[model samples]
Structures are given as structure tokens and as C-alpha cells.
Target: MSNKTNYSYVGMAFIILVFGIIFVPRIVDRIKNQDITRNDRMSQGQDNNFKDNSKLIFLEINGEAKKVPDFSFTDQNGKTITNKDYLGKVYVVEFFFTTCPSICPKMNKNLVDIQDAFKGNTEFGVASFSINPAHDTTEVLKEYESQHGITNPNWHLLTGKKEDIYKLSNEGFNLYTAQDDEVEGGFEHSGNFALIDKNGFIRSRVLNGNPVIYYNGIISEAEKTDEDGQEEQISMLKEDIKKLLNE
Candidate 1:
């Protein structure tokens, strides 16, 4: 072979050696760690595409997964609903009163959006426990449901004994709730929403390996940021709900 041809061959071999030293380990590591996802399902030997649920986690307490507590309340339709009713279905929970004048309206509006986004899916549902059951009776909740355009059959505006509701909110879900004669609405409750999995376990997407625990229910999806500079989480909640449903 000509000396020029021999030089070209040496150049190609050196380039390959450099690539093996610099890139080959990284490529193998990426494949091993699944940093590189392939669209070829046949090679993976999977019947269906699997969702990346690595970021999703259970809300744990004392090293064990925290599950939803038991409770039974009457829905707007006058039918009884309980934690058991949510089994085999994913749901969202919130503490609200129909007459809330502060953040509850915005919260439910966002929830209504979530309901609409996942419309026609029986496996998805919403649980709204009224903080003021005395005023937010089944009849009142029925009206609020109509006002907010909540058409989901599984979305329940529940009301029951005052103590039970408060206990469920403060003690069970840890979403704050209390009666205040000083507040604008004469009541106070958390403006966050909790996402639950199909098996009645509280679930959320993690941030830096820590569970988010709850989603902001007060922000609107249309708003880039609220007055406090908080971005809306309704979009995140919808995406996470889809992940849990597929799980």
C-alpha cells in the first residue's frame, strides 16, 4: 500500500482508540443506568411502553408508606362515600367549604379543571371534604357543584359531622383546617391538594428525591405566577395523576 494510504489507516485507528477511551464507557454507563431511553420496544421485550415512575414516591412516615386513613361521609347525592370507595381508583383530596370566600373558590376551580382534563375516565375521581359541614350540607354542595361545573360522576362534595371533617383534615391528611371568627370566610383551611393512588396510598412526585407531599390548589393554570411569585401546579398534578393511573 502507498505510504499516504498507510497514514490514513493509522489516523482512523487512532480516532477509534480515542473514542473508545473517551466515549465508550459513558455510552455503556448511560445504557446501564437507563439515562438513554430507546423507542425500540421489541428489543426491551416489553408488551407495553413503561412509564418512568422513578420520580414518583409514596409519602412515607417512620420508614413505612403512609396510606389514607379511613372515613365515611355523605356525598352531595346523599350517598355514603369512604376511603374504601376510592380503592381501585386514583383520586384527589381537598378540604373546602362551599361558602369559602378566600382561597377555596380558586382551589375548586383548579380541581374542576383537573376533573375536565381527565373526563370520561372512571378510574379517576376527586374527594372534597367540606370544612364547614354545618353550612355546607348535601343540598348546598349540590348547588356549589353546579356553579363550578363539576360534572364528574366520581367527584364528591362531602359533608358530615364537624369534628369528623376537621379530624380528617388536620389529623389525617395534615392539611390544616380550623374555624376562625376572624378570617374573611369565618373558616380556614389549607389551599393544597393531595394526590392519592389506586390502592388508597398518598403519592406524589419527588423533588431531589423528596416527596412533594401535596400540590398547590390555589393557583390557576393560566397564571404564569401568582402575586407571591408561585407558579401553578395544576399542570404538574394532571401529569402525575396520569402516571399513577398507568401504575
Candidate 2:
């Protein structure tokens, strides 16, 4: 071959190599970013669908979604509190009596942690219903709140008629609560905490006709290791709250 032709061939090969080095990585990175974005979109869509399809049923309504029953009670500060007061807000619901020496304290501590986690967010609140209204009057609940250092304005300790409280606990929240003379605390109540949506529907319990299951707080069995049980519940509760808030 002529020297000029050999030089031309070498120059062409060098130019092709330079172009490949400059553009190949950019092309690959562009494709990678596109894949990442598409995967993210698909993941988000699945998340939305999961949230939308997961329905919390009010057990009293034949496994249908229904609003929580209206209730009127007095808070620790002598203020009349009712379901109307928490309209348009997400809240955690629990059943307890002030004098109980069993799981009530642990449940309250967990609730305290939850309260601190969402502090200053007006969209969230906590409500504790006294199972023994006769003894857990507004003044008694006030003392209990003070003893526990519960200073959150959004946390309300409620006291009302015993019948009303029991009905609300059993029929409304779908929890077990009764005056059991045989029990240590003179009352039998579930330790589970319930998450209620802004629209007043119990969002933490699922009804499957056989029985309703609560999502968080104390459970009959730990789904994970004992050490991680409460932690996992808190984490799941936090995620569920975020989902409801976003929805």
C-alpha cells in the first residue's frame, strides 16, 4: 500500500477509538438513569396500589369499611372531648384504666414513644379511653396525665360513662374490654393500640369475618424476636401512618 493510504487507515482507526471512548460511557449512563427512573415509577405505582387495596374493616359492620361511632367524654383537663373534636386528624386509640398494674404501663410507654415521634404535627393525636370510668374520672385522669408527664396538648385522657366506654371499646374499636371481677385489675381489656384515619375509621384493625386483627401496639405473639417486637411495631405503625397521611 502507498504510505499516504497507510497513514489514512491509521488516522481513521484512531478517530473511531476516540469517539468510542468519549460516547460509550455516556450512552450507558443515560440508559442506566432511564432504567432507574422507570423502576422508581413502577415501584411508586405498586405502593399506591397496595395502599389503596388494603382496607380496614369495622368489625361491627359485617366486614365493611365504616366510620367510627360518635362518642362524648371529658378529658383530663375537664374539657368535653368527643369524636367531633378529632375530625380531620389522624389519631391513635387505646383502652386502659388508670389503676391497672399490668400491661397498661407498657402500652402507655409505647404510646409515649409514638407521641414523641409525631410531636408538633397537628395532623396526629392520641386518645386514651378509660375502661373504668367510675374510678377514672376527669380528675383522676388529670392526675394520671400529670404523673406520666404527658404534657402534649394533643394527647387526651378520656373518662365517661362505663357503659358508653365499654360499648365504644367493644363495638366501635372492636377491642375486648369488660368488667371482669376475676381479673387482677377488675377489668379485662386488650393491650393493642389502634390507628384511626382522619375520617374516623379504625385503620389499624383488619376484619376477616372470623376475627379482627389489630396492626400495632401489643400483640398476643411477637412476629419477630422479643427484643425487636416493639421496635418493629413502631416502625410498621409509623409507615402505616405515613401512608394514611399521604393518601
Candidate 3:
């Protein structure tokens, strides 16, 4: 071959080799990273798709996993209550007064749905404790229960001593519960539903406030559903309840 031709051939080979060296590793690294990312996504999808079967793992209260103190109160039928009564059932506990003309109605409706959802499920129950013991007597709670058609055995509308309910709200659940004497009632409570495991330990605290309202109305008041509405809150609450039940 001529010298010029030979030089041309060698230069072409050198250029090809240099190009391969620069681009091949980058292409291979990109493929590897893409594979890793895909695998990570699949792993996460599988984790989300799988249903967890464990039941009622208690969350820490006051920095420790401890069973709440047991106490006695009266149900709407005037029966006494204690931790032993719910020893083998997962109970949902909420604090409210009958005269609450705001969030209580929505809260009660949600509880009713929950009760209906677990109608035959003996492992679950609902307890609505009166923060205004003086006003929320057994008779008053009975009337309230009747108003809502609460027929499920697992659901109880309870009224008790003011101090007892206050302690349960504040100390047992590690939540804020107080009386608003200025508001013409001895109680003004927050909207929270606590999931109490069979062992009397709290598993989750579901806030009953509807973020969409951000005011007096909760899920029930907004008849016309907005872009961001109560369904989201209800769905989250149901998922949390399921998780707690299957902990």
C-alpha cells in the first residue's frame, strides 16, 4: 500500500478506538443505572401491592409502648365499662359532647360508617365518650344513639365523670382535652378518633377535621363536594384503620 493510504488507514482505526473508549462505558453505565432504577420501582410497587397481615401493633405513648390505665364509665344503657370489657376487640375511641352543633355530627356519621363496615367483625368496636359528663348523661347519649340508629353491639355511646373523661382524653390518649366553661358547656374538645388495640394501647390517632372546610363544617356539612373534599379524609381514615387492624 502507498504510505499515504497506510497513514489514512491507521488514523481511521485510532479514531474508531478512541470513540469506542469514550462512549461505550457511558452507554453501559446508563443501562446499569436504568436497570437499578426500574428494579427499585418494582420493589416499591410490590411492597405497596402486598397486604400486611399483622394486627394491632401499638404505637408509643409519652415515649413508650404502654397500655393505658383502665377505668370504669357508663354506656348509654347505663352499664359500667372497663378495659376488660374490650380485652379481645379493637376499639375506636372518640371524645365528644351531645350538644356539639359542629363537628360532632360528621364525626358520628363517620363512626357509624365504621361501625357498619365492621358490623359482623367481632374484632372491632366503637366507643364515643362524653367529655361533657353532666349534660351527656345515659339518657342524652341514648337519645343521640337513637338519632343515629346505632344498633351495633360493638358500638357504645358512653357518659362518665368529668374528671374521668378528662383523664382519659389527656393522660390516657396523650391528647389535649379541656372544658370551655365560657362556652356555656364544661367541655370543648378536639376532633380526634383514637384506635385502641385490644391491650388498651393506642395504635393510631385519626383527626376527624375536614381540611377542605378549614372552618366549622367537617365532611358532612359540605353537601356539594369540592375539588378537595371529605372523601380524601375518609379514605385516609379507612386506610389507617385497616393498617391498625392488620398491624
Candidate 4:
């Protein structure tokens, strides 16, 4: 047509382009936020299902269930214990040192109680891995085990090179237990009990301490034993172990 008509058409196209530029990201953002809200609701629902139904959500970290990393260590009795030894048994593994002035006692006590509870149940076992291997030799571990009245053959107190133990805790078990030379000897360890199923996959982590007290002074006492939320956590751990063993 004419120049005037062409300019009018170009102006209309420019207005439409500007409107799209201003609103597109906002629309996209609204859509993204809606998806996130949906996901959050689903997660909460799944958590509720666990609490109400007493079922768990197990994550298969290593393809077909996570396998406990293989490593060899000397037990309190100076006997070598390896991943092969626990092939057909369900086991709970924790990291601690004998003389830890912090959480070790409580964690060990809980472990002791677990060992005692499942005593003579050949299908299940417990292992306490020493974090301070330089000081916690096999002899020291043996003495510590005896002092605690831990006598189950299936239960093991293991000690190896300090580096090896640290690596196992950090990498193999996915529990970040490290030696803090600045933090007075013991170890800066997170109280966690990794439950490995019969097939050697880490199924769940039982928080192994009291929020108020890093250590429970006794393993059984640390368990969820009261009406408090603490008792529920402890009881759930027990139930989970039972379920895993039965599997």
C-alpha cells in the first residue's frame, strides 16, 4: 500500500514483541513455581505415609541397592573380619573410639544394647569401627569390648590403620567421620548407624545420638523408649532393623 500503512503495521508488531518480552519470563516462572509446589506436596505426603503406615522409602544408591564397601580389618580378638564374612547376615555399622569423651560411649552403649537384643540371632550382627586406630589397636578394642560386657560372636569391634578407617567412614559408608587434630584427639564424628541389608546395601541411617546429649551412655537407653519423639525414632530404628533382617 503506502508508506503510512507500512509504518502502522510495523508499530503494531513492535508492541506485540515488547509485551511478550515482559510477560514470558513471569509466566514461565509461575509455571515453574507451580511444579515445585506440586513436588513439595508429594514429598510431604510420602513422609506422612511413612509416619502413618510405618513404611519406609528406601533409596537404591548403588544401582541394585548400595553395597557396604569392602574392606578388611582386625577385630578385637585380632581376627580378620572382611565383607565376605557378613555375606548372608544383616549388620549395623558405627564409627567411634573407645575413649571418646563425647558421643562414643552413648553410641557404643546403644550398639551394645543392639548386640544384646539380637544376641544368638546368627542372622544378624553389629560392628563398631574404631575411629582412632592409632591408639585403638586390636588389644585396646578387645579390652574395651570386655569392659562393656560385649561377648556376642557375631558382634565385632574393628580397628585398622587410622587412614584406612577414616577412608572407610567417609567414602565406603558415606558417613563423614574425620579426625580433627585441633578438636582434642577423639574424633569429630557424626553419630550415625548405617543399616546394611543381607545383600549389603545401606538401607537407612539411624541417627545414633540424643539431641541433648551427644552420647546416651547406653545404647538401649538412647533408643526411642519414651513418649517423647526421641523414643519414636529409636523404636523405628529397631523396627527397621527387624524388617531388614527378615528381608
Considering every candidate listed, which one attains the maximal lDDT?
1
The digit string of per-residue lDDT tens for model 2 on 37-144 reads: 211221111111112235443323333455778999999999999998888888888899999988788778777777777778888888899999889888899899
Per-residue alpha-carbon lDDT of model 1 for 1-247, expressed as tens digits?
A: 9999999999999999897555534433333233112121111221111234554666555445668999999999999999999999999999988878888889888998899999999999999999888898889999988889999999999999999998888778777788999979898778888899999988865443233567778778788457856666777788889988898
Q: How many residue pairs clash in each candidate?
A: 0, 0, 3, 7
Report, for every candidate in turn, its global Cα lDDT versus the true structure. 0.78, 0.67, 0.61, 0.63
Instruction: Write the number of the candidate with greater lDDT, choosing between 3 and 4.
Output: 4
Q: Encode model 3's per-residue lDDT on 80-190: one tens digit a residue.
A: 977788877777777778888766887788777767766787778887888888888899988998899687876888877888888877666544567766764555665
Off by over 4 Å in 3: 1-57, 61-63, 184-186, 205-232, 244-247
- Which scores greater on lDDT, model 2 or model 4? 2
Ranking by lDDT: 1, 2, 4, 3
* Residue 73 displacement (Å), model 1: 0.5
Reference-based TM-score, model 1: 0.78
lDDT (Cα) of model 1: 0.78
Off by over 4 Å in 2: 1-64, 204-213, 219-224, 227-232
How many angstroms is residue 92 displaced in model 1 relative to the true structure, after the best TM-score fit? 0.4
Per-residue error at 211 for model 4, in Å?
Answer: 20
Which residue pairs collide, candidate 3?
54-246, 54-247, 55-247
